[model samples]
Target chain A: MGLAERRRILELQQTILPERERELADICGRAIPYAVDWDTFADDAEALSLLEYSACHRVAMALRVVCRDALGREAVREGLREVAIANVADTSAMALTFEGGVLRLRGAWGQRSAGMFGDAEIGALLSARL
Target chain B: MRILLIALLASTAWYGASRMRGASATRRALRELGHVAVPRRLADREPEERDGLALFAFGRVPGSPQYMGSTTPYAERLVVAAWTPTTRAEAADRALRTVALGVEGLTWEADAGGDAVAVGTGTYEANMARRPAWVLVRDDSARGLTFAYMAWRRDASREAALRTLERVAGSFAPALPTAEYLALARARGGVR
Candidate 1:
């Protein structure tokens, strides 16, 4: 996916959907749960494209696969490692490694203000994925 | 010649005694701030208070240079700072700007629980020298405070520097009781 297209998808996932969910809750006079389906982008290429735009979400999904599907762990790790290697030349780019069921980032992607996802959003995304 | 030698000896003694005093003062101040298992070789300078933050700096002896100079070959330094009335994110940003200055290609990670954040980077000094540095920030939400620990070492592997930082972080204990600190903040009208 192109950068613009990926950004549009992220806008829908991050802003539009949440706003719509909030509107529904307001109309119903109670809280409503909205879940994002990671399987929608099941293809590795498409998922990797989204990973560039929304890393923490993709990482959370990848981590969920690592935790629940023992058979898929190696594949997920390989995919993430590929991503890490591809971005090795970008000094400011975020890098990550998964070992012993722990996820580690190579840089302060979370502290950056450049459309990076936050921890709360990661938790919500993970919950939806699992 | 005899008088000159005696003067030189006296000056050396004074310098050694001052360094010892500074290390002891640093340790006392660190104890007051919180519980940290300071390494025996990590001699410290006196704690400095500036703009509501307490800065405690330490460096290894025998080869460590004085106060983070650029000339030391096998130098190592650790700094522990506490910033109050700030969130973890704010503290992390501030530490990056202040403590991690001149570092390049920094990588950061926050724990799965979101309570701790860490940044690792390398510093380039004179003669194209590179050293590893790690900063770990932990939040105490009850007191609206965040503690940042930074460790850097020249001629040391990244793994070793990170291990030193993690060791200090693992052994730290907060000095103030949560309830007591909260009560004091309330009494002072600092917290609602």
Candidate 2:
């Protein structure tokens, strides 16, 4: 990766990172009523390489939303269980699972057949099901 | 006979000096991780050297099997491991991979001061059974280090296990003149 290529990747990351964070925050805000903290880890190399070539990535991001207090934890847990149960047939870019009381949301943007789960759609699904 | 006696005396002095140097390094490393003093119930076990880090176990819970890189003997174990400077995300990812058997859920916290903590549950791969475990990952980026503390219990109650974990986590005191412990406490929402 030359300076120009590195710059391109950096610029692309700068553009997409905040958007992803906002999208995730919006989804969580609408889904859970409590004060939630977001922790995210992304394998940016693959995402950036794919985005540079085809504007898509197989694994875009993995998010862990932690609800600290007991009430908040319980609320997130119940909401995740309900969403998982209700959306058994739904195939989207995002997958939601509850593990050890934390909510995990993973996104794969390369799967064009399975449409991306926009914040509004996710929020609606969560709000309706939760 | 005189030459042999001198050689023996010199060898003994050299060994003593090297041991002193090793002890000093160990103390400094422990202090860097905010362990001012070893807890009463715990004894320092030989550190395990890995690829780029060292895992230090500092306690032996009664009746627990001896496992390298694991102090997962319920309420009385403190395992601290440190890594070279790295991003919090990378450090955390590596720490979890290195320390825990299998991380189920993680609760991450960070303060403006760049101190971060990841608390989570896992299983302790022990002799008889896989025991429930708690792992705490403390990120000290300023010092170019990441520390992981793990504890596991044989009992069944998760609540009690968590309490014991917190108690053990709180027992570590900060090295003098550094407020890293306070920062960690704040990030963890005063878990102690």
lDDT of 1 by residue, B1-192 (tens): 999878865664465334433432112224223445555556666554444444556655333223235444323456665555533354445644545544556676645454545545555342333555565555545544444544444334446555555566556655443333233223323211
**Cα-lDDT of candidate 2:** 0.40
Q: Tell me the TM-score of each prediction against the true structure.
A: 0.36, 0.31
lDDT by residue for model 1 (A5-124), tens:
566457646764455445333433333333433333333333323232244333433344343444444443332221121212123564444443333434322222232333344434
After superposing candidate 1, which stretches have Cα over 4 Å from the reference? Answer: A1-130, B1-31, B61-74, B87-94, B107-113, B126-128, B132-159, B177-192
Worst 10 residues of 1 chain B by lDDT: B23-32
Measured by lDDT, the strongest candidate is 1
To one decimal, what is the Cα RMSD in angstroms of model 2 from the true structure? 20.2
The per-residue C-alpha lDDT of model 1 at residue A83 equals 18
